[model samples]
Target: MLPRLRHAAVVAALVCALCCAPAGATYSIVACDAAGDCGAAVATHNLAVGASVIYAQAKVGAVATQFETNPQYGPKGLALLARGVAPADALQRLLEEDGGFDGGDIGERQVGLVDARGRAATHTGAAAQASAWAGARSGEGFAVQGNGLASAEVLEAMAEAYRGGRGDLSERLMAALRAGQRAGGQRIGAMSAALRVATVAGGFQDIDLRVDAAADPVADLARLDDQFHAHQAMLGAERAARSGDAAAARAQRNEALRLSHQWDRIWRRAARLAMQLGEDERALEYLGVFASANPVWAREEVDDALYARLRQRPQFVRLREGLGAQEPGG
Candidate 1:
């Protein structure tokens, strides 16, 4: 009898434990490192319902966010709540309580968060506007945003992206947010322009880039796409240069340099590396670009050995003579 009672007690305890657990509050956070060329950006969009989807690009430091609400919270409020707050506590405090949102149209909306821990959370609020909003935690170190999203759904997507295949946190989060947007965004079809939130290590870029509020949101977002591609070009150039493949080295270096003349430094580095690998022709091409971009620097770095190698080629000799004749003081 004692054993039977103990077993029954255990069963009851297990049931109680399961019941006591909080119903899976939908929320998530992501760990982001902006070690890439463009640094990082947090882009969010509005979705249907009183929910907002959120994502961010973290570069150099850890970032995290917790979403909670007795009711739903918009992306903006969730972002505010996520600042420097623990995931579980932040969600509980934000959601379990009442009276968080006041007179705002998005008072009762769901919210999601991303932070350094790479965990996420969600809270569904009462009925409210299917609006979108965003925020950066502080010091341009982080950013948060969302629009017309289901709190739980948004958080789920965020977790999926954070845990999904690696490469480009900002791109992953943006893709996730876009997925959420497709399901149902902001109860409207691109009523206003979209925004872009980015974090850079030493660049002048800011936390947000918003469109004119009247243009096509998708088109607006696409306009900023060039910067990301430029970044990819930079990475590809560095990789190809390292591999000592003359064709790839020349192609990537030239492409990168064409995209951003500031990348002349990268081209020069690639040129020198190409020379070391016996790809003198490719190196010379790169040197030409470098010389054209920064003549003074080129003159100082040109080596007699390099000149001798180039002189062996009639075309190179003619090119050298032409360059010398075209110089300002020559």
Candidate 2:
């Protein structure tokens, strides 16, 4: 009778464990191991979890709480999830508090707190599938993805990566996710991938890439991977256009447009700069190219804007007169 009761107890425990296990889900992160092309290359977007908080409070750079939620867990940043709660009382208020939730179903709560200076923190909990799920934290910022994931492992790893990650924090966070996917991500499938990398000093300003429906998460990550380089090309074009040298600006603008069709804006801006430099012929050619490549730019507003500023130039008058009369496409 005793043996039977013990066996029943063990079975019940096993069932509880299985019931509490987290379902596969999604989170955010930084960077990615994207394909070499301009497809959907990986971008940095990490979900800040735990008692940890990252901050860029001063010019000295960012700082992180470096809280280790579960010492018994794997590596320093392996598996962790942080709620508004903390391991200690005094440090509790330092975490970001978020009762609001988004994404999928709430299971394991995790966070990756990061400030402008690149600081980070992490926290986790033992609460699994209670009557309800609620989480909050302070100090560092929070990125709450409501859905519960397979385990807190990826979030914890991402936190560690963000804190100790070399180079760009966002990029390193992407690399960390890549590592997690390899370790055994959601046993099911990922519906989408989203990334958000924010910083005052970073080149790309608030660029977001989302694959709402992809057969392969990694493939989508790859697509996001290339977007970064294309983004760089766009920025470079902007810089070149701003440069005083018209020739240099043209070369950069051409390269920028080559990387992504969206960069045609930079090309138009370059054309404006060329016109300002008294390079009216070159400006007309650039504007003509911009109009041809990006029909949206061929609007009357753009034409009027440039023409309004250049009526005094002889080349401008000739260019205006020859607009519809010259060239096959232009």
Candidate 3:
């Protein structure tokens, strides 16, 4: 009779623990675009969720590891995808190899993946059910996963947003995150968020942004994304100009000009593009803006070949002279 009583107590304790486990987990999406770039976005009740939950490699793949997060799955999963393993097969191997993962173990993990070719996969372990809500959804070029959410609807909202959203890979990820938040995000509310897009063309450039702690992390992340928005337009302008799509170039240039004002570094890019496009007056104006924002750039401009055409211009000569005058009592 005592043995039966002890068993009942043990079972009760297990049930209580499962229902009341820590709820500070994450919701995330991983995706790859037609350009073969990979990226991830994540938000959570915990601090700096992006620091550990997201992983990606340019033209390789992306991974979102949350719940009982095992960061190793990120790089390893990326390597598997790079080797041409399907997303589902890569996840299976990750679980098989994690047999010795002492912390949290496989059952406590939830992950999503996407390769450069748009193949996708996801997993929600049994232990993930201990959280308030946990699940994953996968589609053509993206996978969405979440845990400790207010409701299962968060996962569905993310998947729907990704499928229906427009813009680049990063924008789609952001759209999905916003949708999840509207559907009911992390059960206790989000403390942090992050977004990362791996570079295409041999990993030359990437977009990595984060909102470490905030009253409204997703909103803050969106604010931060504005900087990259301008940067993307700047790159688009350069590409369009190079390809001789003058109308496209003008529109992209206007976008970069309109949005990049708050981000001083983009002035240099605008100047470079203007110079390449033979808009010398605009180039000189942008260069002046760049120099004003970053004083050190004043001296560098005098020697840069990109500005050679303007070197002999009176305005530039005075600008160079001003640098020397500002130096000592010249």
Candidate 4:
């Protein structure tokens, strides 16, 4: 668990109260991993919660806009964090631009921010406090906030879960969302959830997901998270292979293959990459798997120019002859 740390007065006040958000970001957290990953996770009773509440850049920071949300805070805050502004200072500057620091546009908005260095700041506006419950808590690397929730315990549980979490930054954020749900989420019952984590700060998000309309957004999001990791491992395998890290490529490839059997396209993609890596045998193995599960798709893949090298192989000939293939190792 990450250690608790004292925060600036901005976080001292749940410091923001911007404008009314069209849809809610009922409870959320923004954080930075010691590994230079930064992200935001949010669950709300709103469609496409991800489109509204969370923003992150790899080595920069993450921002969560809550209550009467202010959309600009995300990009603007990140820009500030990226420019070397501390989280507290960044939040203040955002507020200043939105209106005036004393109160400005701080209607019912709330915000949580964490810079790449683990510095945190969070603030909930007075307007937001009028809701059933609204507040925020911050520590060394995270901030959790909630409004119109069952109680303050929601954010507290999020903070606890984040601190106790392990593994990748995305996984930890998901754990926190689950914990918040367990503790009693939104007053109206959460209808949506989102999780985003960047492995390269401003680069493509390593894990970006949303459950806009589900009976249980948290559970749905969990399933997506698991599948996303499998895809991520597959990409990792390709990267390792391309970089000439044969051992790493093999290990990640095996993991991807193990985790991706249920995903119809993963095997074909894996096979294509394997062929490019000069692993003819491995390519044959994965293509066999894809063909067994999706014969129609396999036919297209086998004919693709990427597999031209494997065209004359006896095994390839056999596979093409029997598109109705059986599972590999059979």
- TM-scores of the models, in the order given: 0.42, 0.43, 0.72, 0.72
Candidate 2 weakest ten by summed lDDT: 32-41
Error of 2 at 128 (Å): 6.8
Reference-based lDDT, residue 222, model 2: 41
Question: Best to worst by lDDT, what's the order?
Answer: 3, 4, 1, 2
- Judging by TM-score, tell me the better candidate of 1 and 4: 4
lDDT for each residue of candidate 2 in 1-330, tens digit (9 for 90 to 100): 122234433543455466654442444432211211000112112232311222221112222221122212211121121222222221232222322223211123333332222233323322222212212222233222212344556545444544454544345545555554554444454545544443444444433445555566555654464456455655565576566555666566555555444445655665766666667776767776766666654454245655565556665555445444322235
Candidate 3 lDDT: 0.80
Candidate 3 local Cα displacement, residue 299, angstroms = 15
Best by TM-score: 3
Q: In terms of TM-score, how similar is model 3 to the real structure? A: 0.72
In model 4, what is the error at residue 110, expressed in angstroms?
1.2
- Lowest lDDT sum, 10 consecutive residues, model 4, at 1-10
TM-score of 2: 0.43
- Quote the lDDT for 50 in model 1: 16
Best by lDDT: 3
CA lDDT of each prediction against the hidden true structure: 0.42, 0.40, 0.80, 0.80
